[model samples]
Target: MSADLTHVDTWLFDLDNTLYPVESGFMKQAEARMTQFVAKTTGLPMDEAYELQKTYFRDYGLTLHGLMEHHGVDPDEYHAIFHDISLDALAHDTDLLAALQRLPGRRLIFTNADDRHAERVLERLGLSALFDDVFHIGSFGFLPKPDPAAFDRMVEAHGMAPAATAFFEDSERNLEPAAGLGMTTVLVGAHAQDSHASFVHHRTDKLAPFLATARLKEAA
Candidate 1:
């Protein structure tokens, strides 16, 4: 069944792999940076650091969160270093830009990355003007997605009605709380096919096409 978007007045999107295709290697660069940061800070070998980075990401929603919790890492310092990656891999996605422009109402970015990283990515993709605002990890007090409390704060801060909002994310785990809060959840990317979670309202391998052909509720 197709999702009815007529009732959706607010569109929330995740950054990174959600907005851009994972094949672009943008996240690959970021992950490499994470590994380097971990190696430098923890004084571990590159391979061991990479493994630890993944462990932190798996245990904590964001690697930064894990570093903060265990290593008492300076959040600002870590953020600045982690996001210092090249955006050369990303290109302006005109199709996505056009699709976003066609959608009615508020369009916002809900990302685990900081606003600086989000801004740079959006700029690189030529989507800087489409979104109304960005709700980054800093906005959630360093609490990343999948944390129900972070979702609560976002909804409250934005003054959004859950039922009237649609959240598009690449991570199925992160979408769980959005669905639980009554927002329509759309899982994006190739991983969507692997999601067996009943909470996912829609699945699309690509976001531009989904938005292009969305079935909107009829105007009453």
Candidate 2:
């Protein structure tokens, strides 16, 4: 079905891969820290930690969740160690800033990462001022995206009408809950899937260009 792309009063965007280009290498550094932490904490080899991390991320909403449940790892420590990386490689995108400004609505960030991490990235990318608020994983008691409970909590807390909101995310699984709630789900990233299996309502590799048509397209 062709998306109507109208009546979006709230623009919810995911951090990390959604707000910034996935190829920025920030996530690569974070993932490396995660692997290293997992290996050190679980007494596993680096290769084993790598596979386990992926499995945990697949099975749980996030790798940190799995580590907490299975290994009793503290979420705070996980965030501190993994999210402490430098963002020297991330470049500010003026087009994205302009596009975001053009999109008429209350722009908010919905991220699985912690508050500090989200702040760091947004600060580095020069996009921190664009968002009104950022609801991080900690706000939902460490539960990440794709969890209906977390979504419901956020919706209720913000008094957000799911039908009038548009959520842009990089992970296909994360979009499922938003779509289920009648929110328009836009898959963002270079490798975003347009498969029928996905619940995504739209797909865009370039966020700035896609958002450039935001008001006009939705106003149609």
Best-fitting candidate, scored by TM-score: 1
Which candidate number maximizes lDDT?
A: 1
Q: lDDT per residue, candidate 1, 109-202, as tens digits? A: 9998988899888988999988999999999999988889989999998999999999999899999999999999999998787888999989
Model 2: per-residue Cα lDDT over 1-220, one tens digit each = 3345568888899998888888887788888999999999999999999999999999987999999999999888889995658788789899998888866668899999999999998999898888999999999988888889999989987889898899998888899999999999898988775545457888888788887765444431
| TM values, all candidates | 0.95, 0.94
User: Which residue pairs overlap in candidate 2's backbone?
Assistant: none
Candidate 1 error regions (>4 Å): 217-220
Off by over 4 Å in 2: 1-4, 216-220
Candidate 1: residue 139 lDDT (0-100)? 97
Ten-residue stretch with the least lDDT total in model 2: 211-220
